[model samples]
Target: MSISRFDKKIQTPPENPSQNDHSAPEEAAQIGAARVERVIHGGDGLLRLDGKAGFISGVLPGELVSFAVLRDRPRQFEGVLREVLDPSPHRCEPRCPLAGRCGGCDWQYCHSEYQLELKKGIVAENLRRIGKIPLERESIQILAGEPWGYRERVQIHTDHRGRPGFKARRSEEIVLLSNCPVVTEEINRFLEDAASGKILLPPGKRLVLVLADGESPDSRAVIVAPGPQTAQRSLDGLPLSFDPSSFFQANGPLLERLGRELRSRIARDAPRVLVDLYGGAGVLGALAVSGSSAFSGDLLCVEEDRRNARFIEENLLRAGLKEAQIRVVSRSAEKALAVDPVLKNLDPPSSAVILDPPRSGLSATLRRWLKKGPAARLFYVSCNSATLARDLGEILGAYLIQDVTILDFFPQTAHVEVLVELRLKG
Candidate 1:
């Protein structure tokens, strides 16, 4: 389905609902049965209420749902799902008992294959509507893995009673869980042990658990708590050390595949210089420089987080790339890319830049600078499609998208990870 059609049929929530009181009600009231027309980004179902758009959660397209008005505005309304009168054919029994209560997984009720199709539509729709980049559906390759037992890392929150679980949907209240089907068996076992009093956890402290290897839950487990503790892990055969707060890919196997694909792509380009922006722990750079002679010319990693910079240094040294002329700049991508001497000296025709920005996507300063002129080849990794579309729209005039791929890093949820390769226009 075209995004423009959906946009025209459904109105978005007001930027500031308090600006006017045209549809404001003193108290929330029950809205009668509404049929969901389609699913939009962020896993919300779009429907019409009183000739205005209404967004409801825990629903699917073609389902008739009864909802309560949570917030009302002149052109839009927010609702809370009360009951599903008619369900979609793709809907199934959710594995998690707390599916709707916990904010973790939203597409559990929908079939996995259908979820993938919906995600593909979302990516295409976002690119066309927000990015102004129309792409053929067949050109967008979708890569997926086992939908369940794939999460390698998870953060558990503690409640007033010292029980560990995730927060309720859109609220601070904790939903205690004995097991999470989405996480690997190791994490589930750990959760079971913790809840059974076998594992000692202090009250009201968030805990992070990571599996060293993606496949084996028992391989090497790293625990990060609210203290001065460290752990070790290996990605694509490169040893690295990271703290609890460090950023690492949650899916181990898919991360390795992504690394291999990136390395292959970088090797084929034969760039004279490789610059990794928003480099976290320098994993991507390290992977790209592992055995490629083309990247031996120069390698630069720019990161804003001090802790991540230290980890990157330790990782590179551990990888035996000390003589590889690798420079780690501890600064933001916008600042470093703007004035870095190495970037300025690079040969744009034979150079490449790798960008893995945060969910907010590229900053305006960096986007404008890149649009002015950049390396011949650019690789962008984004977790948020909406922001990615917006950024790509601003710079597509200067660069053409050569390839686009979607990685299901997050399954059983509405989130999708996208990787796109762009070539500078002559």
Candidate 2:
């Protein structure tokens, strides 16, 4: 951790005190080496600088490195990794040449096992630091799949030259790529074809291609263009028709496993009513209803987006849950919860609510509502851990964390999906 370990040695002031004042030497020492203590939630290495926490990207834990300050604030500092003088044993060569440049995959430089470990640590840290929930480290289950080529749906940004790729890290400049290592083989092939002028792309439009189940490179893929294009696909055997702009889980291989896990979690509670908030395309609701017979009451799905709400309605009817009571509210979860007198008055012991919020996590209004008590069993699914921890901190008094599972939906990146089962406290 000494500053002298820097690759670029800092120059010392002259021995002759008369020639130069020692005041400048102190400032030079401040720009020296730092040792990364650990990795934080966003895949940044954490270190101490001037007695404050410093976050630097592209370095691993237990590594002595030099960095340039990117941003300075009162309590924390952000830095860009300059050199890893002493590298971590867990660090590996990134498979993709554009690993650092492309904004898609951030953790490609670390081994897959180490990546999982880092994610587990991040979850644990978030729970403890932000949620005030001290979970046993051994109890956190890490579920993983193929570390590469797991993404089924990829949105490729097109530059002015019509090349499809992703944006650079922390930049708006597009990185034109011929192939992405983390996406499915079918998607890579499509990118190659699109890049080679075999397929024509619309100018200035982002292209989203969703591969159907058991689809090959030559098979007809569901293309979601910028305009009015409706795409239909089956996720874990549930027929779903959604607009191209609608949200769906990016990882295809683990969709069935995720669905099964969710269904199992919901069935254990045997709640009478199932309320799915922020339900996109009604996938979770449909899956829960089709798999579990524990719910004899209404299965309500609340979604804010108009297109997604319509798609949820269509998907529910297509799911053929005719015997089961089903309802889709085309409104925000907060709005629906406030306006519906029945939902507002539901008893916690007999009802369950599934919250699959976006990365922003729970809204302030929803957090306040949950603080007042909502359901007996709560299934919270989150893609961002920081916000999840923040939200959990607000309502942990009324709910107990019964189960936690980490789903590696986005491999080769820092992102991971977490599912938490909460039971109402007695």
Candidate 3:
């Protein structure tokens, strides 16, 4: 016997729905033999639910549990698992106190190895649903890297009256998290120290981006953003900068691997002109080439953030490469590319665009321009595949996807980063 959602039409409760709501009820129940229908990612955002959409948390395939049916949507029912009457063989004890609250990771209750399989399934489903890409289940490889200490950056949220942490799955409520077990001890120490007033954070602040080079033994920079200024630091003799909102990759292990892969591909493309769109600190371009033999026409970086644009220049200089046609366009991606005369005048078939856009995916305007742009190839790297899939669908007729590598950047979780190669279709 289990608490089953009875097609009940749940109404929005009063403004102040006690530390509980109508969906959660008087008691929990023990059920048996619940079938796993399907899994759904709640949009491209952090909310990834399996077993059922709009269903409550803690429900997975092959699990019999007592769940509270919270809210019902047109398509799926949302609920919270009150008790796992029959735990799946893949279920595991979560390691973090903030696991359920932080909402940053949705698959903590699942075993790390099992999570990789789930994510791989998600990718295949997305390709089939969105791109009509027919990939057999056996053809797909579920990829996974190290499960712990993989992230180099952590974005901590702030609150005035509540526990400062990430938002809940589908709501704006901030889940209090003083410590996260999955993060490296280095980061956990910083968070613990911050909790004790060692690091002052703005009250009601939305986020605090912490960045460090895992490879750097003796150096780490603690930079807080949108508030006060922060100090500087370096790693592996590479001049790196971070000031609160400088948009550094949070998962450094995968990023390092991703960077090396980009560098390897650059030799083959041998681009004459390189345009870094949505370029944050110009890391991609910097990693692509060695010291001197740079792009012949122009090496450009475009970013809207003035602070990040400066860091890009500083990074370029530190790499010991001459500023041959290096232009930092201070505008949005499309505006910068469209208005710059030098960028437009590059030699024929000489330009290639490399972009890492914000999670909302590339701007539709930007996608339109790139489809018709003179670039020979486009290397689009994204952490959010949902938006990337959406963007690809938008421009499918314009460009053909050449190659794709789904990176297990955020191991032990459902998040995936992909490096996709695109060439204009005839």
Candidate 2 structure quality by residue, lDDT tens digits, 11-39: 54322211010122422333446888888
lDDT of each: 0.77, 0.76, 0.62
lDDT of 1 by residue, 1-426 (tens): 211112122233322221111232445354456788888888788898667788876788888876667677889988766567787899898888887667778788888988888787788889999988888666888778889988888888877666779876666777898799899887888888878878867778777777653336437664645454456667777766666567778887787778778888888877877789888887777766675555555678898888778877777665556646678899998778668898767788888899999899999998887897579889999999999999999998889999989989988898989999999998
The stretch of ten residues in a row with the least summed lDDT in candidate 1 is 1-10
| Position 167, candidate 3: lDDT | 70
Residue pairs that clash (backbone atoms under 3 angstroms), model 2: none
Q: Model 3 TM-score? A: 0.79
In terms of lDDT, model 2 sits at 0.76
Better of 1 and 3 by lDDT: 1
Candidate 1: list runs displaced more than 4 Å.
1-28, 213-218, 317-322
What are the root-mean-square deviations of the candidates from the true structure over C-alphas? Answer: 6.0, 6.3, 5.5
Shift in Å, residue 231, candidate 3:
5.0
Instruction: Give me candidate 2's TM-score against the actual structure.
Output: 0.88
Positional deviation of residue 48's Cα in model 3 after best superposition, in angstroms: 17
- The local lDDT score (0 to 100) that residue 140 gets in candidate 2 is 85
What is the Å distance of residue 335 in model 2 from its true position? 1.1
TM-score of each: 0.88, 0.88, 0.79
